[model samples]
Target: MPNITDEQLARPFELKHGEQLLMSSPKLETIGSTINHWVHHRGQLTVYMRLNDIAVPSIYGPSADDRNFS
Candidate 1:
């Protein structure tokens, strides 16, 4: 794995699958809330997440918050 730096952890990102770039945010909590709200209203749907300022690994698939999973 490549070394991720603090600078990299401070940048906003978008989760991408092929050509599609999903929601971009610097805060994971905000992203989670947005996704939860969407699901509550629109039913369950798969959404992508991009990490900003941190290296989030693949969970189930991949996520910016995967590194924090305990």
Candidate 2:
């Protein structure tokens, strides 16, 4: 999406999978919201990984998988 042209960014974002009555944000705000939503979900998954004793992958920096992380 970083490759998206300025013209593309000027276009309004559309939702195809949900109720049409839902409000929409601008393209850039929608992109930011989507990224925040993903990070929120990933954090939840990491909690699940901890409960199940599963290794969590690196996100912002080195994770437990890195030999020097601990």
Which number leads on lDDT?
Answer: 2
Superposition TM-score, candidate 2 onto the true structure: 0.67
| TM-score, predicted candidate 1 vs. hidden true structure | 0.27
Candidate 2 residue-wise lDDT, 29-57, digit = tens: 88888999999999999999989988887
In model 1, what are the clashing residue pairs, if there are any? 9-53, 9-54, 10-53, 58-62
What Cα-based lDDT does every candidate model obtain?
0.57, 0.82
Find the number of clashing residue pairs for candidate 2.
0
Q: Supply the global lDDT for candidate 1.
A: 0.57
lDDT string, candidate 1, 1-70, tens digits: 9986766655776767889887666655455677889756542222322323444356356454665555
Question: For model 1, what is the alpha-carbon lDDT of residue 33?
Answer: 73
